[model samples]
Target: MAAPVPLHPARRAVGEALAPGELNLVGCSGGADSLALAAAASWHHRKESGPHAGTRVGAVVVDHHLHPRSVEISGQAVRQLKGLGLEPVRIVSADVDCDSRQGPEAAARTGRYAAFRKAMSELGAARVLTAHTKDDQAEQVLLGLARGSGTRSLAGIPAARGPYRRPLLELARADTEAICAHHGLTWWEDPANSDPRYLRSRLRTDVMPHLREHLSPTIADSLARTAAIAAEDAAYLESQAKEIFPTLLEDPDASGALRLQLKGLRAQPPAIRRRIVALAAVAAGAPAPSSERLQAVERLASGSRSRGPVQLEGELEVYRGARGTAEYGKLILIPPSSG
Candidate 1:
């Protein structure tokens, strides 16, 4: 009997994340990382036996139309995905709002993910896989640190969120490029990635290289490791907060305001407490509070000297209940338009 051919590491990685008989859509960008992911996913689903039997792989190429040649690039990606035997290969044009307050990179990302979600719904795919390698993870960590973000931001990009999954987080950018080369694939290089206007692009071109040279040769690996540890810590804290969150709710008022038991909230550690507050605010139709806003909420909940009906984003406000009322020692999240 012939010896079984060894699976390529990229293919193995893709297969490990995917389950049998499930339809998955690869979000290909015609870039090295995404193209390699698409290639590996196709290879995994092509298997007629073993773990991946009956699995189907499709592809979605989102064209943000940010660059002049975006449509052409998307067409090339679709052709490549089709060549790899990916069924239902589709190209989606995203209307990216460059003037968004979130900035260009974030705006483009928002548009891209929206397109991915729509494609998944239309294609009946169980999950949308994107190529976010270890290098990207490291970049995210650096960006978070630069912005002085909290543990959740430092945790970097999640491996899986909702219907989206990133299978290449364990692989390096070089690994993806190598895989693409091995497959004789020519990937498109997005100019935005190297443009100095974007902070991420600047980091990729200048800061990261400087860090790699001056700080540590394996700085990306170290950063990725840090992200993994942070992710574990954040996930545990979030789970704990979620478990305790419902117990703290003290029944909503008639005007659609949400109230939490201050005593119960104050008992938790700072990490869990902040998360719980944020969760409650979101549940009450408020945008996710910023670090500064969270601190303000914390102060209000702590019964600080300043009595506050603390104004939060999305027309929501947080107020501490008066000492004599039935709502005493409660943190009330007043919804929009509630007096």
Candidate 2:
């Protein structure tokens, strides 16, 4: 990785980082990071190529109709992109019910990503660039820790995925803001971001400051370092799992439910076995079972004579057969009725 650079340099770095055949779909949210990213990408494109066969760069702004001002802000963002000499793709808004106990932010994010992925596929986008700065990564790690999440939680946000990339992951929040300001860009300040109703807001406004004052002044940087370490460890663990997982997982339909080879699972170490089960759940899009659920599944597959089946969350069940043979199963996902 090279040293951090100015806005234009960062844009050039992103352009150079992409593969020769790759096309970019920038996610612009009218915020500092995204605005800066759009500007940087435009500058990079102008610097890298002639009018013919120039690198394809477009912008997508997802309108989550959560507030009255959301539509206006999204339009402004698209206009900003157009002003920057880029084509703006508009994604129609979606309504998500965020009244769950888990809070609205998470739900909104889930829906936003869904829409983003849909738009990417519809537009034949090769890769989607996001505006996650280093501070966001640090904040995510802290929030995950506060939730008592497992090792995966500590890994924070990923830099690259199937179609998602975060080119500004190395940049700080202040630097992103400065870049946008230096270019005379304007953005909307999400009111919900400042509302104390959200945990992340409280953490950003209160906890981080206290930590900076009392504990370590470089807490954000330290948290970012911790997230990096956790990401490395998680990657190693996933690699190990990948090597061992093939033997444990069975083929399934489009629904992704798999039958586990209980005999092979039991032979593996307890820790590895738990990870295998968790990974299976993740692959199935079902939440990972609790420790007790894992232990129950273990007992169901073991030599113990259980008269009944071991039931777990998400309708996952494990039943034992005549001679230590066991079956792990899950209910099929039923599509919504067309009525």
Candidate 3:
């Protein structure tokens, strides 16, 4: 109803991350962060007009259909988007089996991304916006470190990947809440966020504070900086891999069995070799092998062969040859069969 305020710093960050006039699809979850992002983007679209001015900016909210009230919450999100002058689009609901080990959180995330991707494809959106913030990045880094993840995992969430972008990654959750308040908007908070039963919730409510008290006061910022540095390093590593991966990648068939010569792989440095193996495993949809397993694979390539096919979680198998030849030390990633 009122003229939108000039772009706040948070909104400016969004505008900078995603240039104005680009066709964007926002993944709005009715949460404070996403609501603020949607409102900011809408304002940006309104104030600027050009060849890209009329550029389409739409909203998609995944119901998740988890809790009984999830549908109602989604409806509220739609109304909020409409209030902010966005055309809201409904997406297909995913039937998530919450009983899985990863639990409802992982299922919802998987389903949410799938739905967003589908909507983006259908709408021909050049890019999609997510509301992952600085706090989330910090949390991710801590979680990854707690799990003893490699530098790749510590890299945290990427700023731009394929059709996805996170404009709010530089801002904290508090800033999002402030932006919503500035716009006279109220948001629904999911109760699950406060439920201590979830590991993340417990970390946020308990572990982080304890760490802040006993450890460095700037732990969050430090972790976030580590993540940023890791991301830059990871990007450079990937770029390097691109130059050699083609030669290193094994021949592929319709069945999607890909094998690379471990001998050739060992010629590269440890970092590059591990990256090649991890990338291959991901392409094969197998759980990425740990650093130890990758080291073992390297040993096999160097002629110290494993007794049998070295299997990694997610179906990636590394075969050791007896002859210590390029053909003998082969790594194959067998793709997951269709369910």
By lDDT, who's the top model here? 1
Backbone clash count for every predicted candidate, in the order shown:
0, 0, 0
Off by over 4 Å in 2: 1-5, 16-19, 46-53, 100-102, 249-263, 267-270, 282-313, 320-339
Candidates sorted by lDDT, descending order? Answer: 1, 3, 2
Better of 1 and 3 by lDDT: 1
Candidate 3 C-alpha lDDT tens digits along 1-339: 854443477667777666455568788878999988988888666455643466556788877776778888888888878888876455557656688776877877887888887887777777789999887888888888887777878999888888788988877787788788887777888888779987778777887788879998777788889999999998899788767777878677677777777767888887888788777777777876887777776666666635346667775666654556654556666665621
Candidate 3: regions farther than 4 A off: 1-7, 19-22, 46-52, 249-257, 282-296, 305-307, 324-326, 329-339
- Per-residue alpha-carbon lDDT of candidate 1 for residues 141-252, written as tens digits (9 for 90 to 100): 9999987779999999999888888989988888888778777788999998999999999999999999999999899999999999999999999999999999999777
RMSD, model 2, all Cα superposed? 5.0
Every model's TM-score? 0.95, 0.81, 0.86
Runs in model 1 deviating more than 4 A are 1-7
TM-score, ranked from best to worst? 1, 3, 2
Tally clashes: model 2.
Answer: 0
Native RMSD of candidate 1 (Å): 3.2
Candidate 3 has a TM-score of 0.86
Worst 10 residues of 1 by lDDT: 2-11
